[model samples]
Target: KKNMVKTGKAALLLWCQKRTEGYKGVQVTNFTKSWKDGLAFAALYHSFYPDEIPFNSLSSKSSAEILEMCFACGLRHGIPRLLDVEDIVEMPSPEPFSMMTYLSQCYHTMEGGQKGRSGLASIQVNESQQRQQPA
Candidate 1:
């Protein structure tokens, strides 16, 4: 039962990386075998098929034990959710007037001018005038 559980977790981890919908542009630089991987595999499995199995009854070993094993690898060594992998297809250059630039220009025009305050200046001036008045 223990061996089968371990094997199932390993296969699931490999399968997650293998799928297209999996992490984009991620490479499997290193595969770490730890309890965390087992927990993650079980979690992923449960997420996909909630009706298949219950979390509490996952393994003969206590859930806490499994979880500790998962994190036992420590910060230095653990399974990376995604690794540094380059995309095969080259992306095209962005247009000169992209939405971001266009929005920035609009915001600047509305907020204030480069030389001095524009929209906010008038509001400040009015506020100052009101403050001067008794009230």
Candidate 2:
């Protein structure tokens, strides 16, 4: 999870360097510094909000835009997504979203379409939900 966030930040930093610095007609040193600063900012953000692994759909958007969004959210008592617990602990945990979760979603849906289960519920519904009380 951390790795994913780090990688995404690195990618965003590179994108920022390629776009803003090149467009501003800034000096090479200044451009280079901005690029490096962007990277530093990204690294700092990931270090803190390392869990909000770039939402797949968000990643589909422009990297610069995504970076901007993250930067915005990082401030102002943002979502503490790292811990995966929105309630208990105050500080956010640095855990990324599970890729397997999305993969499983796609896998199940694809498989479901192929095999039309002759039932309504995807999982067993009438099964025991609690421990049996013994006499």
lDDT of 1: 0.35
Candidate 1 local lDDT, 17-108, one digit each (tens):
43213422233322332222244433433343445434446567654443443223221232321211111012132232231232223233
Task: State the lDDT of candidate 2 residue by residue for 1-135, as single tens digits.
Answer: 986545443433333333234222222222123322223233333433456523433435543454455445443333222212221112232122332232223223323534523211222221222224344
Q: How far off is residue 2 in model 1, in Å?
A: 37
lDDT of each candidate versus the true structure: 0.35, 0.33
Candidate 2 has its poorest 10 consecutive residues by lDDT at 81-90
The alpha-carbon lDDT assigned to residue 18 of candidate 2 equals 33
Tell me, by lDDT, which candidate is best.
1
TM-score of each: 0.21, 0.24
Q: How far does residue 70 in candidate 2 sit from its true spot (Å)?
A: 2.3
Candidate 2 — which residues are off by over 4 angstroms? 1-33, 36-40, 53-63, 78-135
